[model samples]
Target: MAGSLWYATAAPGPVLGPLTASVRAEVAIIGAGYTGLSAALRLAEAGRDVVVLEALEVGERASGLNGGQVIPGVKHDPDILEEMFGPVAGSRLVDTVASGPDVVFDLIRKYEIACAATRTGWIQPATSPATLEVIAARVGQWRRRGADVELLSAAETARLIGSQRYLGAWIDRRGGTIQPLSYVRGLARAARGAGARIFSQSPATDLEETHSEWRIQTPQGSVVSAMVIIATDAYTDRLVDPLRRTLIPVPSFQVATEPICDELRQTILPEGQSASDTWHLLRYFRLDPTGRLVMGSRGTFADVPVAVAARHHYRAVREIFPQLEGIRYEYHWGGLVGMTRDHLPHLHEIAPGLLTGLGYNGRGVAMATVMGRILADWALGMPGPELAFPVTPLAPIPMHRFNQFGARMVIQGLRAMDGLARVRDRWSARSAPGLSL
Candidate 1:
């Protein structure tokens, strides 16, 4: 449990040197993660001269360190989305998110990204009957919209998951998994091939509007462009104070076991599908191409200790797959997730020539990729009403400086609630002999 397993194993790609001198482009993108890289690729394909500025190497932050679970839909359900933004806008949002995975896999294929991409599907298991109801409703809503999603019965869920811990589950064939770091690097490669320039280790220290153009100053050089994109999700810096204050950054910790024996792999996630439970503090697990079992969950914002946080993930793995009680974990790491108050991705025009997008909650993998295209479209003069996500004014979150403390409290409270729910679920199962827990 030390560094990122993705970076440790994935094959390296061409590295872009840092910005060395002043450059001019039609569009300058800040941050070289999924969103920024994707926007760069699309813009380059559209024949726009674009330059991407990265603080570190590409995919060095949340983009490369994420769970790599390619889930569909917004953070919330379709019905909830409709309720939040009304029927027309909500349905449009739902349609956009539902197509996210296609955008991801298509890029991988078109670019020949060697990220161990898998489209086996994604599963959401329900640990209790109440959660099962939620899954059922979700399946129904998605199915009504012609998505290839289905609700599994208790026996079917157990068979597919190789665990009796869940009462039911929902499966979306559109979802998948990938080596995220490799995917991002491949995107950089493709973007470069399409004539976009990417500068690594170049942090944008200052952003200002000069006349009708945007000027971004880096330590080594500067980028002057007609438009700029702040695609720096959870790792937002002080340069974009308004965008930074609009969301809370929460950490997600992950641990992966050494590749298990083929026999053991057959007994866990046999279908090779990624899965997560329906809990306030959720746990997600998947099998890498080499059979290593990877799992992750919510973590603290403050640096209390790594061993303390790693223990929770270890306990969760053991609880689900009892056969691997003493499995040796090979990697441990965490990354920040930009969570918005409404738990949906945010797209905004902070000023006339400056635009920014962030707050993917925990669904950054697919959402971020889709957001890049949307951002590129916006930069190409697409109207706000025609965009996938609504473009709104940037509003700072109230008391954002104290958000870390609030995040810690919320994590603790959710953990307690989850524990209590498990206890109550077990009690109810014992009381009603025929009931499924």
Candidate 2:
């Protein structure tokens, strides 16, 4: 079931009976993931009649099949944005993202959502010397931008992570983790409770623009709405062709162990913070409330397992924690991340009465939830720059359909280069003259 884990290992109690006939609504939202459901909740709360069309069920794709990392802010670094667009505009963007988590938390609390929400924070661990430098710089940049962040030394990092493989880490209290599927499903429930109509197992096949209204056709019915929001992310490529071209689908995989030793659980991530290494192809791991070590990483493997992409995650997890060697991986799964060419989110005003927001580049958990609220506000005629990200929509990658080959090549090449750098750093540490070496 697409939303099984999200509804706490049970399938979404028979998706809201499908839309069997024509309906009219103030807004029709396509895709019932975090973005769509969150927006539905917001719009419904404001007394607007909203209808959500989901292909399968709420949180069916990446929204539910993700690492559950509730990261704060947009994917791009502030310094990079500053260089591209001057400090003023860049600062504002950074400021908005810095406050995004609070907005999401407020909605969760207000709606009384039960997604096992936790604010235990997150740590950016450095796997190599170069990575340490980058993490240190990011910590400084975030601090200067008024984020509650700090860079930790190797000793402190080890104390926090119980792993000597990392050289240092960047700690931030703003970020956290969640049971992603649960959060989005909870949002759907909240939206319904607020008087929104959600039709699951219904995909918006055709979007018709008629006399200033948007008509979305599903399998068995249609919704004529004053406004429409395309909140599918990776799934948007199906209905919107240009979106498929602009947003590259990158696959991310995860695996979960049955449970670790009690001693290991007590020592490693006991406080429950989500942790990821500072690598382009990163490894993220966190323990569940039940002590299962759920681990994830970038890149696909040749062999796919029956359970949640287990083998790929197993290899990556073992590399970091050799103690877990030969352990059985009980849960395995994979999902596609809608990665933009420039590694930023996409917010497009496709036409009057129709808007689309997608391409979160793997940070969709909080970003999608927060963006949903903003998109709902935009549909209600909220004016200002906050409704959308300012970057002009660029042309899709040349021959984007052929990008799978390119993405694979780039990932493998980067991993090789990073491996070489790690070797050099290790050799240098062993050869140092005066100190312990």
Write one digit per residue (lDDT tens) for candidate 1, span 1-437. 12889989776867678898999999999999999999999999999999999999999999899999999987678888888878999899999999999999999999999999999999999877766776888899899899999999988888888788888899999999999999999999999999999999999999988889998999999999999999999999899898989988888999999998888788888988999787778889898999998999987655688888898888888888888988999999999988887777899999987888888888889999999999999999999899998887898988888876787787888787777877676522211110111
In candidate 2, what are the lDDT values of residues 1-437, reduced to their tens digit? 33223334522432586889999999999988888988898999999999988888677788878888878876667777677657776777676667767877787799777667788788988776766777777888888878888998999888787677788898889988778777777788889999999998888889888988888898999999889998988766557777678877767777778778897777778778899776656788887777778888764634534343455567677777777777776676777888777777777777777777788887788778777887888888886365534535536678986786787777777666556755665522221111000
Q: Give Cα-based local distance difference scores for all models.
A: 0.88, 0.75
TM-score of each: 0.96, 0.91
Model 2's alpha-carbon lDDT is: 0.75
Top candidate (lDDT) = 1
Count of steric clashes across candidates, in order: 0, 5
Deviation (Å) of 428 in candidate 2: 11
Evaluated against the true structure, the overall lDDT of model 1 is 0.88
- Name the TM-score of candidate 2: 0.91
